[model samples]
Target: MIYLTTFLFMLLAYLFGGLNGAILLCRLKGWPDPRTRGSKNPGTTNILRFHHAQAASAVLIFDLLKGTLPVYLAYFFDYSPVEIGFIGIATCLGHIYPPYFQFKGGKAVATGLGTLLPLGMDMTGLLILTWLFTVAVSGYASLAAIVTALAAPFFVEQIKPEYTTPVIMLSILIVLRHISNIHRLLTGKEKKIVNWKQ
Candidate 1:
């Protein structure tokens, strides 16, 4: 029954992961599907960049919840660190390649953050700060995500040693999802967010 439960959780997590808020919201608001807009990503940053903040807010909440729920479920069920980690992976992948959206999904940053939020506030807080600070200084959401993901394994390991490997796996997945952005950043061709009010 252990294997069955694990399979079920991961399966449900993957399927739930398939539901993306960006695409759904666009359809409802009659806006162009986010996939066709700036960055062509279904992540919040893309939505906020091309669309208004209200639309992006809805997407962010949904994406964050989707990421948070699965890992929270695994944790609630007393799954081992490794099992939780795998569930986290499934959730992120589902976001990256949601079946409902033709397997074309957003970068897994928010989803990954959602999965980790349940682990503990200490690590999660640090992670958020890192992302925020990076974005504030660099104006590059992709760069912020990459930096935070790379920092995740370290902070998580400090607080929960057993979660080190699994967290590292999650981190790797997040980084891989941002490969295109990384290439653009290196070539000086990436678009950076500018504060209009400034």
Candidate 2:
């Protein structure tokens, strides 16, 4: 019964995570569909490019919340580490492949942060710091994402071994989703988030 309950919770979490918060925000603000502009992604980065920073920040926060809420609920229910891990990973996956977006969605960076933050603040801090440092130094979102994704599992294992597998799996998905960005970065064509104006 516990396993059944966990499965149901994970399913609900996925459904919740699958909401394209940026797209919804865009629609509400009467902005163009985010997926049709700025690298054709419904992520906070793209939203920032086409919309106001405040709107983009709101989307980012909500996207993170979507991933955080499920794992938090699992924890609140006193679910085991493994169950919490499952919920966290499912939430990230749902953000990447949101049903509301026809299984098309963002790169899941912010959502990944959400999922990781509840599991281990140290791990989350390391990932965020790494991403920020990389982005600040190189001005490449893809590079920062790739490096942080590679580093996140290591941090998780070191700080929270019980969640090693789930964190590793989430890292792999993040890296995979960023593959195109990696290619573009390599080819010198990836967009950089310089000034917010464009």
Candidate 3:
């Protein structure tokens, strides 16, 4: 029974994760598919590039909720921390490669943050601060995301050791997803937040 319930939750979480808000709003407003515009990603950053801040904000909130709501349910149901980690990563993966979206989804930055904040507020706060600080100084959103994603496991290890192992596994996946950004940074062509203005 326990296994069955967990499996169902995982499935629901993945399908829900695939429902990208940016894609929906783009079509609603008659905007071109985000996948064919801007950075060509079905996430908030690309929406901001193709649309306006309001549209991007909506996408951000929606994506964040996709990660938050499902993982929170795992906690509310008293699942172990390890199980919660699995649920969180499931959502992230859904965002990265949602089927209905032709397997081209967002990079999962906002989704991953949404997934962890509720589970470990203090550690998540640190991660958020690190991201903001890095972006402010470096102006590279991808760099900030990479740094924080890499650091998440250590914070979990110290504060919630039981979650550490799975968190590390999830962190690896997130970092791996950022490989393109890493290469762009090395080539001095990575997009910065400031670039959004012009």
Best by TM-score: 1
Per-residue lDDT for 30-105 in model 2, tens only?
A: 8899888979989888888877889889998998888888988888989988889888888888888888878988
Q: Whole-model Cα lDDT per candidate?
A: 0.88, 0.85, 0.83
Predictions: Cα RMSD each? 1.5, 2.1, 2.0
Q: How far off is residue 178 in model 1, in Å?
A: 1.0
lDDT of 1: 0.88
Tally clashing residue pairs in candidate 2: 0
* lDDT tens digits, residue span 4-122, model 3: 88888888888888888888888898889888876677888778776789999999899888899988999999988877888888888888889788878888888888888775679
Q: Count the backbone clashes (under 3 Å) in each candidate.
A: 0, 0, 0
Native-referenced Cα lDDT, model 2: 0.85
Of the two candidates 1 and 3, the one with more favorable TM-score, higher being better, is 1
Model 2, runs deviating above 4 Å:
195-198
TM-score of each: 0.95, 0.94, 0.92
